[model samples]
Target: MESTEWHLTSFVNLAVLTFLFLCSQGQVNGDCPADGRTWVPFGQSCYYFVHGNEDRFKSYTIEKAKEMCKDYGLLTVRSAEENSFIVENSLQVWKGGNNNMWLGMYYNSDDDEFKWNDESHVTFKNWEEGDAEDPEMPLIDTCVILHAASGKWENVSCSEQPQHGVVCETPQIRLQRKNASPLLSALVVISVIMILGISAAVWFLQQRKGSGSTLFPSFEYHPPFRAPSADQTCLVEAEEIDETS
Candidate 1:
């Protein structure tokens, strides 16, 4: 019985220790942000290709496109790699006539320079040669387009040109809700394990008690049956002998 109790206690203790060890080594989920609709991650930012509706196959002007991207983020671009990322993804979308998409850049006649909608410096330009300048209509073509065939930028009149697609860019930060702390999760698991262990211990003790095999058996005092005294025995024998005679 003692050995059985010792084994059970050892098992429970080992379970508890194992639970604690695993809890201490618990890990949280990865920190990568969740991907959004049509959004792809490249480097430290996310890019989305806003596809046109099926029926109309519509496109947006530069101003309208910026307004569309307003809820999520600004129409933006920075690097050649970023531009390429957008172009490649946008190519996957079903294209209509020109297959051109609006870029966030425009010609600034006042400054005689090209600038992004965010007013960032244009370090990278993928413009096709002889594009962005028209001898016939010099300053009219202010907006830029990513030509579908060549994946190069072309200057076009924003209003005169029919609507096209737009690319939306935002930083690759966690889009999902923050996870609970690893320590807190571990503690919760540990608590569950402890509760189960305690419940098991209680069940085992109850089983032992039900089977009349408790840790401490109750003791009752009862004097042993006493033999007859020598004088009593002798008198009984004499009486028996006299009666027989």
Candidate 2:
């Protein structure tokens, strides 16, 4: 029974020690970004596709689409990966047979440059043949659209074209609760280890007391002088009597 308890205690101590070590090392928990309101997670951002007649109006222009996406996130493409993700997931976003949607790209005739709605740098482009140009009327097609059928881009007049849907995107959020300072985490870990150590020490002492065991057993010491036996006493008396005689 004592051996069983000892083994169980050893296992508990080992587990506690392992937990302490892991805590001290500050291992981060595997927490992914949350996808809310049916938004899809791709890479480091969350994407939302607005389509169907449920919340959409009869006609939605680029400016109206931008207003709708304002509450969700900015209406723009951040990278080529994001653009590809949008293309692949286009059908899933809107299944009402519409193949074209508004992107965040717009051409500015003032600077003679195409830029995103958020005014970010345009590092990637996926324009189709003859897109983003007007041979007869230059600077007429300013807004961009993702052509689902061709999986490419085409520029249309922002005010002239009516879109069936819009794609909104924003960066993924990191959980703030898990981001503790290293010193605070270390202090918490050390406190837990100390508490476990103290509890184990007390338990060990209690077990030793109940088992009547000592770390170093001491022996009782006796004097060399001992009381004489009956025979020895009689012999001593007789010798004393003879001497007296």
Q: Supply the TM-score for candidate 1.
A: 0.51
TM-score to true structure, per model: 0.51, 0.56
| Deviation in Å, model 1, residue 193 alpha carbon | 27
Top TM-score prediction, candidate number: 2
TM-score, predicted candidate 2 vs. hidden true structure: 0.56
Query: What is residue 24's positional error in candidate 1, in angstroms?
Result: 16
Structure candidate 1, residue pairs in collision: 59-163, 59-164
lDDT of 1: 0.69
| lDDT by residue (tens digit), candidate 1, 1-245 | 66557657766776787667555554433232354466676777766667656633356777788887875554455677776666666656544344677777767777788887667668877778877566655564677778766778777776675677776767666444455687976787677677667766776776788688867788999999999999999999999999999
Point out the worst 10-residue segment of candidate 2 by lDDT: 27-36
> Where does candidate 2 stray beyond 4 Å?
1-36, 54-59, 96-98, 179-188, 191-245
The 0-to-1 C-alpha lDDT of every candidate, in the order given, reads: 0.69, 0.68
Evaluated at residue 185, the lDDT of candidate 1 is 67
